[model samples]
Target: MAVLVGVGMLVAARPPVDVLGSFGSLLQTFLPWSGVGVLVLLALAALRRSAVTAVAVLVPAVVWCSLFGGMLVDKRGAGAAGGDLTVVSHNVHDGNPDPAGTARSLTASGAQVIALEELSPRTAPAYERALAESHPYHSVQGTVGLWSTYPLRDVRPLAIMPWTRALRATADTPKGPLAVYTAHLASVRVSLAKGFNTARRNEAAVALAAAVRAEPLDRVVVVGDFNGTTDDSALAPVTAGLRSAQEEAGAGFGFSWPASFPVTRIDQILVKGVTAVSAWTLPRTASDHLPVAATLRW
Candidate 1:
């Protein structure tokens, strides 16, 4: 049984079938959590006190470490001392109970660039009022918005969904012009009947990726609630050419959803041609999702 478990993990490393409602993507979403299996195997090996079981346990342990061990070490500080820009992304739940307090909490981070998703007309006013002092330049297209301390230009809405759920803008920072994309991709679901449903989110990801590819700006920053992790194959279209801020310079997984007890990272700060100095998740606000913040050099 121990050997079989290790073998199963090795098989999982390769891409699995996705025809059955994106089963492969679903597994990939929580692939990091598979390490827990190794712990169970170790306990079993200890109880049996068999050399064979001990050797079998080593298989999955090595595989899990090889897959995510690097993330355990601290890779920050390269750009930590002096970063050219700071950005934060959050899915401030539409049904949040305290919009004013949430906005205040976000502003306290002092991120120069902030992108928010799931914003409704009623709650947006509170954000606008609270951010007016620090992030003077702001743009909102439908449910998504961008607030920045620098001047903004060529602000436009993206057609990734039926209604407005994404936007793009050019931030005129001291470094240069940066194409900033704020998006809230269609949410996915999991059910026994349909398995993992990601068709809508996959289509939106393709559209978003196309926009990023055609962007003329040399520096680009994509911040939002992706609804899928970078590991999920369904999001490859959008993550193919981009670098995740957390993977580049963060201490751990940096999960940002379910503010009470986050298990996976859905909100992301992905960049192209911008150096990520540090990436971290902020304390919970009134929103269901915790905010993700990153500092960039250039």
Candidate 2:
């Protein structure tokens, strides 16, 4: 039993051959938790006094550790001195009770570049008013917006979804020009009706990935609520050339969803042609998501 389960764990990373693999991908999003399952097996093995089962348990345990062990060590990300440039990404739940308060929390982070998503017409004004004081140069393409201390140009919306949930622009930083994109990919759902309803998110990722691949700038930063984890195959297109800030510089898993208890890191900050010196998650705000920040250098 141990050897069979161990082999299963090893083969899990392979793209799903069928529906089971699709479902496995969903479970893999929280793959670290699988260690707990192995623990349960170990307990049963001890109670049964089955030495074979105990030996089997080690297989899955070792396999699980190999896949997710690095994240267990929270290496210090950035430092107090900070990086040359700071950026933040957030999905300020449109249903949030206090849009102004959320905006204040974001500005408090001292991010020179900010990307915001899920803005309705009514709440948009409050965020604009609250952020206007600190961020003088800003642009709104569809529901997404970018606010920066430096000048911005070549701003436009990225039609990854039916609505304008993604946008791109050029941030003319003192160091140089940085192409930036803020995106909210289509939400995914799993239910009895559908095992893994990822078609929409997959389609959006394809379009966004094409845009990112076509980007001409050397330094590019893409940040927002991806509605998919870095492990997700659907996001492979967008993630192919870039790297996630959290994986490169975060202290730990850096999950940033369901502010009450973050399990999956759907929110992200990815970069190319630059380094993420530090990446970390902020305290929970009035919204459902915890804000995410990253410091970058080329």
Candidate 3:
């Protein structure tokens, strides 16, 4: 029974069946929690003291280990020094209580390039005033903004969705010109009737993917509140060529959401044509989501 249940989950992750496969792909976001659920089942089996149950427990034990054990291990393998650029991405909840305090916290993070999402017209000025001192060069397109210690050029807004939640820029760093993108994809909501309502998010993701693919810059970094983890298949289009900074250099599964009890990572920093030396989550701020940061080197 345990083996059967475990195999069923494995099949869901990449079921050859169409609809079932699609639904199962969403399982990736809660993969770790699923592993825990299986462990709970193992405990029940142990309590029953059935010889067969003990053997059966190994099925999911091995299955879950094979699926996510590697990610659980510290992946901060040997890397070079903190590179020439450090970037941070955060989704400052639109209804945040203290926009000014949050701005102060984010600006204090020491990231040379900072990307903010979910900015409101009301609070945008406070952040602008707070970040202006450190980030001399900044651009706001729609609700997303990029502030850089280095000069920024070729700035423009990207219509990944109808709303102004994404933008692109070129950071003229001392090292060279690096393409940067700040994005806030459509948010998703859960309903008992529809599980994960992601139609809009998925469409926007496709648009963002096309935009990234057509970008002329060889070195590009995308930072944003992606609204879906790299683990979710829905993000494959936008994540195709880029590597996740957290997965590459963060010490653990750098979950960044729901500030207080983050369970899944929706915010992200991904890069291509560059190496990530380190990635991590910043201290909690006044927003509902935490900030994610990463250092990169060419």
Estimate candidate 2's alpha-carbon lDDT, on a 0 to 1 scale: 0.84
Cα displacement (angstroms), candidate 1, residue 10, comes to: 3.8
Write model 3 residue lDDT over 47-119, tens digit each, in one string: 9987888788788888887876766767653433558788999998777788878877877777889999998
Query: Which segments of model 1 are wrong by more than 4 Å?
Result: 18-21, 78-80
lDDT (10s digit) by residue, model 2, range 1-298:
6676667766655556465645765765766566777888999999999998898798888887887777777655454355668899999888878988898888888899999888778778888888888998898877788899888999999989888999899999888999999999988788997877777887898999999999999999999998878877657899889998888888788999889999889999999988888888988888888989998987
**Higher-ranked by TM-score: 2 or 3:** 2
Q: What are the runs in model 2 whose C-alpha is more than 4 Å off?
A: 17-21, 46-52, 80-82
Q: What lDDT score belongs to each candidate, Candidate 1 first?
A: 0.88, 0.84, 0.84
Using Cα atoms with residue i matched to residue i, what is each candidate's TM-score against the true structure?
Answer: 0.96, 0.93, 0.93
Local error of candidate 2 at 23, Å?
2.6
Top candidate when judged by TM-score against the true structure: 1
Clashing pairs in 1: none
Residue 63 in candidate 2 has what lDDT? 86
Tens-digit lDDT string for candidate 1 (166-244): 9999999998999999999999988888877888999999999999999999899998998888988778889999999
Q: What's model 1's overall lDDT?
A: 0.88
Model 3 / residue 98 / CA error / Å: 1.8
